[model samples]
Target: MIEDHPQRYALVNELHARPFPSLTVPCQAVYLAVKEPIEAANRDRERDLAHLRALLARHGAAHPAPGATHHSAEIGRHVLKWESHTEFVTYSAFSAGLCERPFDPRGSEVFPTDWLGVAPGKRIAAVLIRVEPLPADMSEVVTKLEDWFVPESLAASWVLDEAAIIAGDFQIDPAGLMRFTVFARPGTGARRVGRIVQRLCEIETYRAMSMLGLGRARDLTGRLNALDPQLSSVVAALPDDHRAAEATLHELLELSAELESLATRHSFRFGATGAYEAIVNQRIDVLRETRFMGRQTFGEFMRRRYDPAMRTVKSAEHRLEQMAERAERAGELLSTRVDVERSAQNQKLLESMDRRADLALRLQHTVEGLSVVAISYYAVSLATYALLPVAEALHWPKSALTAVLVPVTFGAVWLMVRRIRRAMH
Candidate 1:
């Protein structure tokens, strides 16, 4: 056999990993999402595997293969589907039939409460969904919706080209569980109904997950407001005093550091929120919803409620980026101002040194003049003594000879000093 890439089989199997459950009509499902305080990207997969193993052990069912992120198991009278994601895990149990009373608690009792309490993470979302066979007339559907869900908050639609009618109030009840109902038309295959139900579950889950970013954005807004004015004040001072600019630069650096820290800490969550939001929208679009009872559909409800919160998150992310840019610009401007001030100071220093150098040159000229006069006097005295011996022979006066030699000696000394100065230069 030809060698293949090591991950080829695994990558191919991933497409079929989370297949839709073949759910029948006239049944109910319980969906629960669990999330940790920390992200699951670096979480311990062994812990999740252990939890799954524990649940499997309770039902004497086969364990899921190691490293599996999705599993479906039969637990006594119901079917359980578990999927692990980057930030959370979801558990969905589908039972064979509905309970006697509408919205009864028995349908959700498939998983023992004790087991749920010991799960690895806190519950993020809990939902109860009922799938029923559609009746002949639209009047019965309308009456059932009014009785089951809140009128003002109801979001109902005909999905899958009217192959199924789906409705939800999108509100939490006393049990802290959101409720949904799907009425599948006759001749709709089990797999198709299952796909519709799974899509609805995913829409709810991803919608709730995406809202986490909004909560973080709200928390950061106060800090951002406080930082804004401080940054503005620092930048306002940049053009004036260099000393003050230095101080302001320090503050700007601190602010920039804080902004970068915040960005690093929350970047993953913000990005994940965007991804999950897109998934929610994609699932809703695939539903191809049409209006029901002239009420708002799921897509409309998301637009009205969920869209605003996502906008807030985007606004927060953008605000952080703007503040960081402002800090960087302020630092650059302050640095330039400091450089100019240093250059001006250096110019003044050079001018002072020039004045001192000129004074030193004048003092050296005075010393040279004194040295010439002293050397000329000494040379003339020596010449007079030497010519005294010759005066007796030539009958010449020593004083006159000395007087003649005095001017010549002074000239000779001056010339020698000038020559030495030129050679040194």
Candidate 2:
């Protein structure tokens, strides 16, 4: 066989990892999403695997293969599909048959209480969906929907080219579950029904997941508000005195650190939120929704409720970025001020040094002149002492001798001093 890349087999097999369940009409399902802390990305995967195994063992079902991220198995009368995701794990239980009552809460009973209690993370989203045959009379379906969900908040749509009708208020009920109902036309394939149901469940789950970002954004608002004025004051103080600028720089450093910390803490959550929101929208789009009974469609409902929340999240992210940019600009300005001040101080220092150097040079010249005078006087006195005896022998005048000797001594001393100074240089 030709040599193959080590990951080729795994890479090719990944696409078929989570096969869509083949679900028939007159079926019910309970969908659950479990999430840990925002740091779920770094959480231990072994805990999740062990939890899955525990549930599988309870049902006497075969365990998922090692290193598997998704699994599907039959547990008693229901089908169980488990998918591990980046921040959470989802479990979907599909049981064939409808309850005697409309929107029965017991439909979720397929999942054991002990099993759910031992799930790896907190349940973030729990939904109950019912798939039924579309009645020949559309009015009867509309009446039932109104009875089930609040009319003002209900969103109903005919999806997949009117092959099915999907309706939900997207509200949590007293039972702590969001509800969705799908009415598929007769002769619709089981696989098609499953895809529709899965998309509907995904739309709800992802929408709720994305809203976590909005909650984070709201929590950050108060802290951000407090920081805003402090930052503004720092920027405003830039043009002030050196002391003020220095203080502002210190404050800016602290503010920058706080901003970075906040970003570091929430960056992953914000990014994950945006990704989940996009998936929610994409899932809805695939439904190919159309208006039902002149009521609000899924797209319209999201545009009203979900879009605003996402916008708030986006706004928060943008505000944080703007603050960081502002801090950076302020830091640059502070640095410039400090540099300019230092330059001015250096210039003054240089001027003072130049004056001191000039004074020292003048003193050196005066000292050289004094040294010449003193040397000449010493030389003239010594010569007079030696010449006194010689003058008597020659019978010459002492006054003339002394004057001539003084001039000659002065000249000699000046010449000698100049020669020494030149030699030293």
Candidate 3:
């Protein structure tokens, strides 16, 4: 029957041409990638083949049919092509998981265990089962599956039933390709492949949950920014003695970097097949980086990382304003004290103080205006000083008195300053 189907030979040939990572299990590996309406050509298929090859390489596995005998089966109403070995299987999607099952199992006396073992080492059986729909709900499905394959009591020998295998599985890629994974225990015989499939399913479920968490985090970050317009101002206002605001900001930045790293590790790239693995990897990365603290500590870190950082910034600003007010009050108190101390030498002291205050205020105003005036004056003075020596060298009028020319020099300087300022405006 297999020899008569030339298309099966073509399929096997194609699978062998691609790179697939070889697993130690006597199981079949299945990877699914969505095909769009535009990609319904031979060229597109060739491209998809290349992409699948890359995905297998990333997972540290090789294509099973490379120079080896294999079997081919069309799955999901012929929407997916499956390449199978004695122990392993690989499924490639011709379309998204949208195919209808052509045949019903009512008349056929197929056992649940038989159906479970049909895919061999393929870790995506749970996903396929879910998509096909059982005659019962998930709970009933689990119950029926447990009846077929009993789980072991010992951790070392704990066998997976079909229901336990399917519970936590489902992954949707960015391009909307969903993959289910199953994990197998070491040396658990053929049934280990079922465990691998179950693990894949669970990983998918967690991936979806993590994505929800990420969305919530993003929303919270946006709300924090909206609630606090001037984080820097708030930070500046914090009490002079309190440095927690600055520390909080630094910690929040560090946390954001950590989250970004976690997301990168967890996120599946376009055209990648292993969404479940990516999510699991990302979750593990985050847990490892965060050091698996208590739930309260994790919550605190999140709050501090996002909202409290803004609060710290606001606190800093409030403190600054308070400091400014205190400084102004202190200056007034000092002035009153000085007035009380100088009663004996009142007239002399007051006159001296008054002159000094006037000079100080005038100096402040002069400094404020000095940049333009000083620059212009220095430029003109340099030119005039140079002219003084030149005039002497040329034996010009000695009565010119360069020092007396200060007023004229200042007038020219003022005009130049005005011109520059006007040009700037």
Who wins the TM-score comparison?
A: 2
Ranking by TM-score: 2, 1, 3
lDDT of 1 by residue, 209-236 (tens): 9999998898788889999999898888
At residue 369, give the lDDT of candidate 2. Answer: 99
Question: Global lDDT of each model?
Answer: 0.89, 0.89, 0.38
How many residue pairs clash (N, CA or C atoms closer than 3 angstroms) in each of the candidate models, in the order given? 0, 0, 42
Pick out the ten consecutive residues of candidate 1 with the lowest summed lDDT: 239-248
lDDT of 3 by residue, 1-425 (tens): 43567687777877655332223332333333222222112223333344334434444445434433332333332223333322223453222232232112221111123433432222322233222222334455445333422223101111233222222112233323343322232344443343344334334343332233344344444544543344434334444334444443443344344444433432332112233335555433332222111112222333343334334433433433443344334334434444444564588888999999999979865774786567656866676767777778877664564555566777776777668767977
lDDT score, candidate 1, position 215: 83
Off by more than 4 A, model 3: 1-126, 129-188, 238-279, 282-425
What lDDT is reached at residue 112 by model 2?
75
For candidate 3, the 10 contiguous residues with the lowest summed lDDT are 150-159
Of the two candidates 1 and 2, the one with more favorable TM-score, higher being better, is 2
What ranges in model 1 sit over 4 Å off? Answer: 241-243, 360-424
